[model samples]
Target: MKNIKLIIIGVLITLSSGCSPELESVNFEEISPAIFPQSEDDIEALVAAAYYPLRGAWWDGFHTTSERGVMFINDATTEILMGDFSVQLYATFHSFEPIHESVTRFYDDFYNKISANTLSIDLIENSSANENVKKIGIAEIKCARALLSYELFDMYGPLVVAPLELLKTPLNEVPLARLSNDEMVSFIEQDLLDAAEDLLPPSETNYGRFSQGMARMLLIRLYLHQKRWADVEEQANLIMAMNHYDLESDYVGLWDTQAPVDSNEVIWAIPADYAGTSENQWQLMVLPSNYPVRGGWGTIQSSWKFYDSFEADDIRKTNLIAEYVGTDGVTYNRSNPGTNMQYGPIPLKIAEDAARNTGITTVDIIVYRYADVLLSKAEAIANKNGVPSQEAIDLVNIVRNRAQLDDLLLADYADIDTFNTMILLERSHEYWCENGQYRADLIRHGKFSEYNIDLTGAASETAAHKTVYPFSLDRISEGKGEFLQNPGYN
Candidate 1:
């Protein structure tokens, strides 16, 4: 696993640098499958390469490839965050523009990763390796592919669920039509279920590796998106039964840069080198201009509405720094967005590391946490019977209590509608920039549009077609009329 991490780091650096012509000149015949996978290390290396794209989705610092910008994409587009409108050229916040570079790059790179994952699976499955390696390796790669597919589906609806057998087929013979939205969901669910069989439970696998916990956690999110309330509840319970994960007792320390890497709260986290080998670039995007540590680009900050949404005494409010004394002895008020270099409520959840001026930090990018399971189970149960159950209220209180806030009783909420609204709000506070789950949360509650947000030119309600984003113009051009772009873009 350490070797795999080193390989990932090396690959990212090479990718961040210019391409190599010498590397390109090497013939495909020199690296055919027959010669590779002769050893376990070789197989692991192949699997590691498949996961390389996951890091590219958020880190690597490249303008076109770094998905770290997704932090801006998810938050700025919603009502919870704000940046300079002039600087918000990506259009995820201002308007749903199909030509946005980040959207196109994100879409293209994810598909590229899916292709890499498929090829990795083909190589491992066909190799004469130990059966256990084949099983677990293939399972992990499949889960990785499923994760990428889920994100793609979330962003762009009804994309091609590329056939596994196509791994063996020539590109010229491959078909590229997309699955129906329902078919795509089923395909992803089936893939995750199949993956769960061979994976160890959470914390049993290597650091940064996928596990049964991640599989079921993802399934819970999938079911929630589909409004499969019963399934969501069942999946969350299944994860709890695993008994390998629980919330970190110290809610504030969980986000601390120096927190333990093995915190029980984290079900799955993408590892980064605190020593600066590999890093999460989010701090570079979110920290204010004059923060105590190394400071950052100050591109994104919390919206005043989001800052005010928290309870006055809630410890989670520590995630938002309303005012702070800078190293330069200037007292900054983050509540005012109009002043020069001033943006409302800075998201200090991801702290800055003073050691590196490059904006890279040791913070692990978390994908799944046990607290989310609790909150999700709460929401699912409340919706199960169209009324907030005692169990639902108790589950929510578990999260709230951890945040040093008082518990809520069933009487606090007037009806199921009100309870559901609070649950979504709780999720916004707890999981802010963790996994991009908040977007799905908003869409699930039917609040993902201008109806809830205050964009200047937003339509009265979000168009049904706008729920899923449009296909990039490059992808459409590459398909050359074979692919159908999402509705409203054309």
Candidate 2:
């Protein structure tokens, strides 16, 4: 079973890295920047590093709802998996620890390229390069910086200082500084703002490059998270007005091989293809199986909590889970609705395709999309105004209409608390597999301990510093100068 899943996982990895092709090489002499000016070739090498790897652990490793359970930091899994010993004093909350520990590799990886990008930007600003190349290069840096900072913030949170001046200051001299969350967010906002102005408007050639619309989409997300209602609504309207993309009619087909790129739903996705080792989302996804029935590899399974929330009417419920009978005739289900006495449940969010005969298996992992923008706008409206405000309810209805889910009541029989609670459920139901937000959704709503029946063993936490992940000791040892080890880790 392991080997079967391994092979399937291999196919996934192969597709992701563009199936690296054997190549011929050209010879050139390398010279120091002090001796000779930077050339387009030199700039390309540096930016390529940042461009190559974009997935942070959270972004890629714990990407799906089924696998993303660890990030939620609750006791449900412990109760189910470790029934008797959950209250043990040794249990901890390391998920909240800062990410600078394990993430230094990505920083080193991208910052080196960012250094080169900075040089390229300087050349563009001062030198006699073509206007198009200069604009493109500037846009590229902004795009690259946005990607890096987004990764950084999600993992490490805001530090107290700015990150850019540390760009080329040499490893030893860099001081450890933490940007406040507000400061970190401000910097990220600035990067997208710069990109919006520097980028070409959306079109074909720019399809491969950053565009104004992408920047705006990014801004839309930032505003949503920051609770900026008006800005979120405005940006969403702007993108929708442009009409470049439409939601894929078939929800299942959004992941299907023939899923057309016709819709404006996607703003940016990590470019993936079925030819390489470095880029497959499936490498980490497929569960191994050996029976005559549809084979599957069970690396991670869905939470009973998540599966229970899905209504019978929602199409997304089908997309998020798969039910199967094992070779042993065991019904595989964890979230078996307490009513079902037998069986286990696997993630239906991604499957081994209906047509496996073609060997066409590459999955496009979405980073952000338009539906999120609308939700963000709706949430923002609710945050700024009360839950029943027409605009907030209306925006929420748009999403409900698309998903065919029920809407908030027109009459104000219940208070805002009731409406807000409904909104949270809708967001959870609709966006479960889209982002690593399901578990966080549980935490935000304070419900992991409730639905989780098997929550007793390691679910108990005795550690003093038990909210987040700890910065690994190894990261500091790897020349991460001045970076503080997160409070709870070591």
Candidate 3:
């Protein structure tokens, strides 16, 4: 597996920096679709390459738990995280503009992977490998492309997806416009659907690789974003019927240093190691610079408002450190917030790795899990029926029960609006620092601006137009009047 991963990384490097034709004396075996990926191992490597950008690497990986990745950026946009840095303030207070580097970072960094995956799929299809290999390879690549596209689309509305034919030619100078909203949704939906047919089931798939459940989970999320309540319920039900997943018995145990990568609850997790292809730096991101266990950069914090919102006895809240003694012999807490506590509690979602001397750890970054499916079904059922159902309430209680909270009564959440509010809050508490989908949840419920305004008092900066972020100024310039920016931005 390590050899395959290294080969994939090599493929990415070769793609980025092609062999120089100027060195004519040195014969170069140029890698291209026409010649490479002819063997089974080659096809496997190509598929693995499609999965590379989604790893936890700081430079380009999209799912790193740290500030550079989607989890931090998305969580920062909500009350889940706050910071003193310019980019953190921009995200937390909704003060982002077209020129803000952080606002444009995701798209600028990973958009090329869409075409890269497309090229991989094309190569695998044309290879002389067996039909089964080709089928599986194509499915994995499609899933990777869809996952990458969905993340980008969730932030920036549609994207300019270049065709494989166009990608094959260099210096073509053909500019493209972003897809229509429906077109973009259909494009991603079709890819996921296709991938789900060939992906291995959860019981058969490796921990970090994409599976049938992962593909369906992505569908559930996309449907939730589109407000297709019936579709969400259907997809969530399909996953539930897989009978291969369940919530972890202990809520906090999920993030322990020895947490199982193949936990029944985790649908998809990026496997990380301190020395490797992927890394998890959550401790470093939230821990104080003088923290006794492991000194960290203290880059971001959870808001006090968010901390106080949790039920006192909730086991999930145990991970959120409210007070701790620093290496300087100073206690940091809400009352005596030296430098870190003022922002809020340390949002240490993962347990402290005392043995580690570096920023990265072996903690696998959980993306989609079974609890999200249950809550999503609950939300979908209520919305689809126009009222909270007994089944819906039960689904939610399953997750709440794991948190050691009492079951919520159906009568308490009578209407769709009331039920949705409860669901949103439940989601916020359950998945805050996990994958950063709470921001999308707030936006889907039309509370993005309102919640931020109430939490941060940034009334002037919070608005409906800020629901989808603006395209970067550089992208707009490159569009040459062809690519229009998202609404409400110049």
- Candidate 2, residue 357: how far the Cα is off, in Å: 8.7
Task: State the lDDT of candidate 1 residue by residue for 1-490, as single tens digits.
Answer: 0001112112322211111111222222346566666566556666665555565234432111123445546655565565654324333354565776655555654565666677677778788888888888888888877887887787777676455565444344443667787998998898799888888777677667788988888888889889999999999999999877787888777655674567877877766554433457766776666677777777666666777789998888786777767767877774333342353677767655666776666666666799999999999988988989889999999999998889998898748989988998899889876676787788888877743345424432346666766777766765646677887878
Best-fitting candidate, scored by TM-score: 3
CA lDDT, every model vs. true structure: 0.68, 0.47, 0.83
Query: What global local distance difference test value does model 1 have?
Result: 0.68
Q: What are the TM-scores, per candidate, against the unseen true structure?
A: 0.87, 0.73, 0.94
* Pairs of residues clashing in candidate 3: none
Segments in model 2 whose C-alpha atoms lie over 4 Å from true places: 1-48, 55-127, 159-166, 169-172, 203-209, 283-288, 291-296, 327-331, 334-344, 354-360, 412-414, 437-468, 475-482, 487-490
Report the C-alpha lDDT of model 3 over 200-309, residue by residue, as the tens digit.
99999877778999999999999999999999999998998999999889888788788477699999888787765678988888888888889888999999999999
lDDT of 3: 0.83
Per model, state how many residue pairs clash.
2, 56, 0
Kindly list the per-residue Cα lDDT of model 2 for residues 34-145, writing each as its tens digit: 4322455434433333344343233433222222322222222321111111211112212233343332333333333334445445544664545666666677667766
Largest lDDT belongs to which candidate? 3
Question: If ranked by lDDT, best first, what sequence of candidates would result?
Answer: 3, 1, 2
- Candidate 3 has its poorest 10 consecutive residues by lDDT at 1-10
